[model samples]
Target: MTTPSAEPRPRFAADAMLGRLARWLRTLGFDTAYDPAVHDPELVALAAAEGRVLLTRDRHLVAHLRPERAGLITDDAPLDQLRQVVAACALAPPPALFSRCPVCNAQLRPATEDEAATLVPAASRALPGPVSRCPGCARVYWEGSHTRRMRQALSRALPGWIS
Candidate 1:
């Protein structure tokens, strides 16, 4: 096994059951890996290989792994799960919204006007704001109602962390 880094930004791999938690983490700009097809052993191995802290609701799996590397989430609610994770890992919210693609877990990049014109929907294009695109999936993102809601949720979850 490889030694974990001391200065590593917290990375995570969530088990199949924690899909919502995984997406929320990605929304917070965390590098979270989630795939329903991954079984427990493979998921644990992947987390170990990638230097990630494994997040799961499976107590059995957690019992099988080193305590330092795995976190078993007890809460059923997504917000509670998020709170548990933040408290457990001592996480700080991302500095910017839409910094990562919630779907593919890829970092988002600024979309050029031309790119936005071609890629963004007509309704979104008409809105006055900057847009970003995911290089992995080419999905366009903007500060729309959904973004505002997510930001609000994060702010509430980690008060004074997100501006």
Candidate 2:
């Protein structure tokens, strides 16, 4: 049997049930579209229109889509769901961690120290590190304890993927 050629990592559109998984995928630098308000049919259409893989837990929905363009997520637990998607897609570690906004799904831009100081809480401003800001949500990000913890968790989940 011929091994399937590894495809370029796909962009994704996650159904409402996979919100957490979408955020994690975004955190890992994948372009994932997730809107809880988007109905299944619209999601399928959006995925098709945007050339995104549809990641869903609905068996019926998966059945309707081309198998090569969709993945059925079976796990209920968020972490397990994440692992399932990663494995299904053969995803690699993000080229840049925190490249996308977890809340709004927008790409993050580097924030100047002054901009970060103005946007972030005093505690976060006191930390010495570069920061990124989401242009859509205006949320500031820094390498604080929370980011460190998330990095640790991602490293554990993906193994040799996060640095």
Candidate 3:
């Protein structure tokens, strides 16, 4: 399969209705901005200031945005919405799965062995793969069965998007 574009991929902001979609985007390492309580005006402004494509289910919100600055979500399911956004935005596959913090939308860094010792659960540290940490929220990440399940979800939802 072909990658998205030569230019940098656009970041995103999802409306409150698309919280799940936002998290999924972050799962694929996209810098997505989402706030469950943000108002339409504020969300629009945030997208504009940050050069983000606003993904929303609200037609009224779509009306206020320039066509390029908005994506109208037409599906109820998160995975379907994800497919639509991925196509509309011409997104590329992520450099690494779980490279971004799904909770805070921050890029995750590889955790030092010392940091992992303190932050990661002993059970998880023993599982395999390196640990990662989100600087924004201090949440730690490690490859575990959950990560494998998430990867499988991605593989099913988006064929050939993740390896």
Candidate 4:
């Protein structure tokens, strides 16, 4: 296995059962694209086309593929699944903050309150500080309790990660 620094951080495409894992990957700042009802062949094809590593739970789906982009998810639970992917991909360190949108798997850009004002929800606008904006989905983000829970959960699942 390649060391963390030596391994290239791969983009990802996750299968149906691994949605939680995909979301967690996005939280960890990986570019993870997830879709439900995607056939194995389609998943593999998407991975190839987009140059993303396929993340899945099915043994057969994970094993038979010849794509340079693939990793078999080893855990059934969300937290464990997240840990498995992180370790398997050798992405032990946290990636740059706000690099990805947690909801739609789009790339996020740093935006000021004025720049992101339209995208920002009224509740969010009235609420707080700087916001991150997803250019593809036009989703606005501000770190909150949900993000904190995700961070804490990830901290527990992957020790020494982002350290």
Candidate 5:
């Protein structure tokens, strides 16, 4: 008999205080929305409209919305928060989520330094060979200290991940 296929990764919308978490989710290639000013009710509606899971720290908001596609944000730190979601969702860690743009929630695209010369800071551009850009927000990103930190955290949180 054939084994069942793994479920698709779940999408998410994060509340105000969970901005960092939302960004982390995006960094992990999850379609995560981070609207700091969005109210609980609006978040609920948007999550429903988009068929995304609501990620929030507010217990009342979760109870009020009660969306089947919802998950609670337990930890305060961004990495910890991601770990919680990953564990709760029973997702494969590491490469399962990586190299996504957090700001606009877009996948990162490869571009040569020459190609991105006009779009990135001189300091940033000078540091690397090629860079990645967010098609949705036009933000640029590359492997750096932040990536190391996040990788370390992912390691700590998901030791079982085959990486």
Candidate 6:
């Protein structure tokens, strides 16, 4: 297996059962496609088209056509499911945390301070950090207490994987 620094992070497509895991993966800056309402066959086809490893908890999804890039998520809990994917995919440590939109799986872009300041409250504008905006969802983001909480969770989910 390749070491964390050597391997490129794998793109992923999670089945409906692994939606939360997919969000976490996106939060970790990985390209993760997730839709809780998509049908199984369409999900499989999407994964194939995107060249992503399809993470699923369904036995039938795995058995269907024996998809080469498919992986079965054995754990029911979210973090444990993440652990499985990290090990099975030989994932590299994420290069950028909080770089993708967890809700939409879109890469975030830097927002001008002036532009962001107009959106948040006067007190929030005083906080020091770059602001980001999701193109797909038009949601704003910044490093704050939520970042700390997520970092803590990732520390537990994959020890030594994040700072």
Which model scores highest in lDDT?
3
For candidate 5, give the lDDT: 0.73
Worst 10 residues of 5 by lDDT: 1-10
| Model 4 error, position 82 (Å) | 1.2
Q: Can you write out model 3's per-residue Cα lDDT over 77-105, one digit (the tens) per residue? A: 99989888878777878877888999999
TM-score preference between candidates 3 and 5, better one = 3
TM-score of each: 0.89, 0.90, 0.91, 0.80, 0.80, 0.91
lDDT of 1 by residue, 1-163 (tens): 1224463458899999999999889888889999999889889889889878899998888877653488889999887898899888876566766688999999999999899888888877887678999999989898778887987987887788678
Candidate that beats the other on lDDT, 4 or 5, i.e. the better one: 4
lDDT of 5 by residue, 60-80 (tens): 887876865778787888878
Single out the weakest 10-residue window by summed lDDT for candidate 6.
1-10
RMSD of 3: 2.9
Q: Which stretches of candidate 4 lie over 4 Å from their true place?
A: 1-7, 64-66, 115-129
TM-score of structure candidate 2: 0.90
**Model 6 lDDT on a 0 to 1 scale:** 0.84
Model 3 C-alpha lDDT versus the unseen true structure: 0.85
The better-scoring model by TM-score among 1 and 6 is: 6
lDDT of each: 0.83, 0.83, 0.85, 0.75, 0.73, 0.84
lDDT accuracy of residue 62 in candidate 5: 72
Q: How well does model 1 score by local distance difference test?
A: 0.83
Pairs in steric clash, model 6: none
Better of 1 and 6 by lDDT: 6
